[model samples]
Target: MPFRRRQLLALGALGAFAMQAQAAEPAAFPSKPVTFVVQQSPGSTGDLVARALGDALSRRWGVGVVVENKPGANGMLATSQVARAKPDGYTLLVSGSTPLAFNPHLYPNVPYDLRKDFSYIAPIQDAPFVLLASPRSKLTSYGQFVAAAQARPGELTYGSGGVGNSTHLVMEMVVEASKTTLRHIPFNGVGPAMLSTMTGDTDLMVSVLPSALGQIAGGKVVALAVSGKARVAQLPNVPSFEELGIQGPPTPGSLVLIGPARMPQPLVERINADVRVVQQEEALQAKFREFQTQIFSGPPSAGAGRFLREYEEWGAFIKARGIQAN
Candidate 1:
């Protein structure tokens, strides 16, 4: 249900604020349609999650929620497009780890500023990455994997989406913490990287759970430890780095929804409230089974603060690690 004017008026300024939010707007706020700009390819985990949310929101609002996939230039094209959009909440950026938190440092000339450009809606989900090895490979356990990597430093190659991407950096953090070395192979995305590992072209792959779950269940890849503080419920037997007495920080996916910055406070609150509601629905919870993604719905204030902090931290992580695009 749309927010009642009476409830908004109870906040007093929020009612006046929401009314002004629609002023000086072309046509009306969302009078036409809303577009969700996803920086990932179609059928990707991030894209699928956004589509689900978009579908639900569209059904609720009686407006078309079209998802536009712009998967190039390391998400610069999509980020730039949305950064310049009107702050009327019609144009939302369905951002993943790369575009929002890690890109500004990787690219030489960024087209947009993450902190200055978007009003965060909520964190979509926080899934951890899984490390997989081929079934034929001798590296059976995490200890064996480490032994092989140590025996031939920079010999056991691992695939990631690209340098400075979450897959790459997380593994780098893993190797660095463990005082090990391996060859870092960069791919355009997780799909290709996982295929590389499956085909035996790469010895290791660090990828989000969704991209690797099918192969892991099919007995193609050896399910090694995950990069999380706790083991994923989906893969109950698979241990976590922390459980193994490993020392890396808790790593999780950074997918979140946002609009252009300076969006009206009331609009942000209204959307956040709706998302909090969406988070509680059984249908969406059932949908999470398909992807093994855990929803992390919260107010925009907490989500936005997370974005800001990670945006800065990733910038430093990128340069310090000397990760680069090929």
Candidate 2:
């Protein structure tokens, strides 16, 4: 009994030593440059938005901020990278509605359990959808787009970024609500779909504003309507789908930041605070608007909670639409 007690005491001492060693490790949380991984190609609206915010953070925090582009894999490549990253603050993600909200519904076997694998840092911004048609086409407004489509019945084609994307679902919901029919053209990306519209490869692309802005300004494509509650500031004259008497999905996509789950609450709070400050910088906001997007810096820890509700709602919506995850 005496020998057993000594052995037990030694084991307890070793455990204590290990705990203390871990706790004593210098908390130089971002002692080095931090990497912000994004699931978008260069020049993409999401990528540009991330760079703007990253520059601001670099200036304010005095620590180097690097933006890495990790496109493709349906954002799964970057999402998985951020999900499996250490809970430390060094690695982060400029997550969009793709990985944060829609992926849960679109992927049959999501690798990272959102609720369990992520710590939502802060809501970055909203990317509203715009329903646009080719300029050479006769369609002038949402009503015209719908009426022309109904007249031809599946003869009109609408382009999408890809399957399970916000643009795809937006068109689906709009067609279902307007009681009209149109052919669906799934493209590799928004750029390709928009190009198809410009070349008359497709009738229109229910894409985000950034994807269609240049062509709209060039008169190559027509500005149909914004798919939101209010008019976009960039195109003040444009009306919303609601104004066109068409109601579908509201607030199609947004950009947000999140880290791996089990992140220390203190570290999460530090990152959230710094990021919120960066999101509100006047210069950053200006650049964001240049892309026709808005920044969202909500309460400190509210992002995670918001994501939880958003995930549940988006999942239900996808299921209701009978959209398969594949």
Candidate 3:
């Protein structure tokens, strides 16, 4: 054989051997421990859900799942970390609407692009925002809250996880629809923002249902209204914004699992399928119910589409309201 032909044949043989070797490697995903990066504080709803899902996944896969809380910069810290991580399915992000949908619109220079930087794995849950007033405050109902806001304008202060987060944006929508104004007090996370209302540091806040449930039950705060289309079962007495005559699309916050972009398609499908199975478990469902979370597990494409839709909706809303981060 000619020398060049022999060299080509040898290279082809080596390539075939490499492909066969790679195919023979273990097919089981999560061969090693998995890390879920969370963008909320330890006790926040996002953190709680991440830990719960991680525990369930660990049980299912027989591998350890770690929940890391890296809360700061309106969730940019953990989000950017996950966006830059290797797309090996080992490093994941348990993020809410903020990082994936709302932040790019709210910030002038977000580090990562939602469409280009991450792979949507699965949606975990969706919880409506609940308007809460300090138990000490006289604002006891949605009507009273609206009236007070209109009467006082910027005198009425509201606390939120942060500026540009779903918590803040939802409240802004409510205020706009009500034709009222409220001072925004941004905090590091829902836990701190809820605490601000409980301590009367802020007059009111619109927080995710799960994060505010404990406070509402303990009488530290009063449930004024929920931002869902209907009243939340956990707080039946609390009216929804629609029932209060406020009109707009429901502004529920969502939590989704994602990984760095360009992850293997098979790996994404496997993880998403497992998440759906875990979310449907009776025990997990009950646990999430107790926290006022409604499971929303679905296909990765659906999750991606929802994220994109929310990005456009929130971007328009923020611009219309002239909302800006502090």
Candidate 4:
């Protein structure tokens, strides 16, 4: 054969060999345990989401899924820590809008650039808050609560997780929309804030529905209004802020799955697809409904842009209202 023909055959053989080698390689994701670093203490909404996802993923992938809580700095600590982690798809961050979207604006020095240093993998859920009035306050309806707050401008106290938490910022949205002045009593976490409101130490509180569902069902607190676009089935009697003709917060607090920067697109898509499958399981969907959270299902690409949009929306709201990470 001529030299040119021999060279062409050699190149073709090399291409075939390369394709075969690539086909022989096994999928690398979830070959070992995946650690989900939660940005809130155990039992918080973020932690709950992480644990639930971890369990489901563990069962699906036949590997252990560890949930590590590094709750501090309004989620900056865990978020930055995960951002600096290896982008091997083994270490991920399960966090809410506060840390993922709002922290960069609420805190003076966020350690990570959300757009540059993180891969938004999948959205776990959209957990809207329920506006609860202490039963002792005799505020049965959202209208009545607004009237009382309006009448007693700064006298009626509302509790929140902290100064810059979603709990606090969302209430500011309510305050702005309602044009009422309610004094803020910041607590260590939404749990304590809910407790304070239940005991009537605070007259009103806004909390993620999962944490406040038991109390609401037992009549410990009056569920005045929820923060999402529609009323949740669990709280059918209670109305949403939109239903009451009130402008609610820009977004209901969201839980998202994310990893360090530079994770392969295939890996991100794999995880996103697996999570959507897990979310569709009837048992898991029922559990989510019990928690009063709506599943946020989408492609990985969509989640990436969604975070940027939410970041801008919440950042503007935070800056305009002078919210601070106190």
**Candidates' lDDT values, in order?**
0.78, 0.79, 0.85, 0.84
Q: Which pairs of residues clash in candidate 3, taking residues 3 or more apart in a chain or in different chains? A: none
- Per-candidate TM vs. native? 0.88, 0.87, 0.90, 0.91
Each candidate's clash count: 0, 0, 0, 0
The collision pairs in model 1 are none
Q: How far in Å is the alpha carbon of 246 misplaced in model 2?
A: 3.4
Itemize residue pairs with steric clashes in candidate 2: none
Candidate 3 local lDDT, 1-326, one digit each (tens) = 99999999999999999877654442677789999999887877888888888999999999999999998888899999999999988999998777767777777899999999999999998888888899767888888887888887799898887788777888888888889988888887777887889999999888778877888889999998888678878888888888987765447488889999988777788899999999988878888977778888789987887788888888888888887877
As for TM-score, the candidate ahead, 2 or 3, is 3
Q: Which candidate is the best by lDDT?
A: 3
Which tens-of-lDDT digit does each residue in 1-326 have in candidate 1? 35797666678987677767565333344566789999889988889888888777776677888999998877778888888998888888888767777777777777777767778877777778888897657677888888888888888888887777778877887787667888888898878888888888899877888867889989878888887788888789888988876664345476778888788877777777777787778877777778788787877876677767777776666677787665
Model 3 stretches astray by more than 4 angstroms? 1-26, 249-252
Sort order, TM-score high to low: 4, 3, 1, 2
User: Model 2 — which ten-residue stretch has the worst lDDT?
Assistant: 21-30
In candidate 1, which residue ranges exceed 4 Å CA deviation? 1-29, 249-252
Error of model 2, residue 160, in angstroms = 1.1
Off by over 4 Å in 4: 1-26
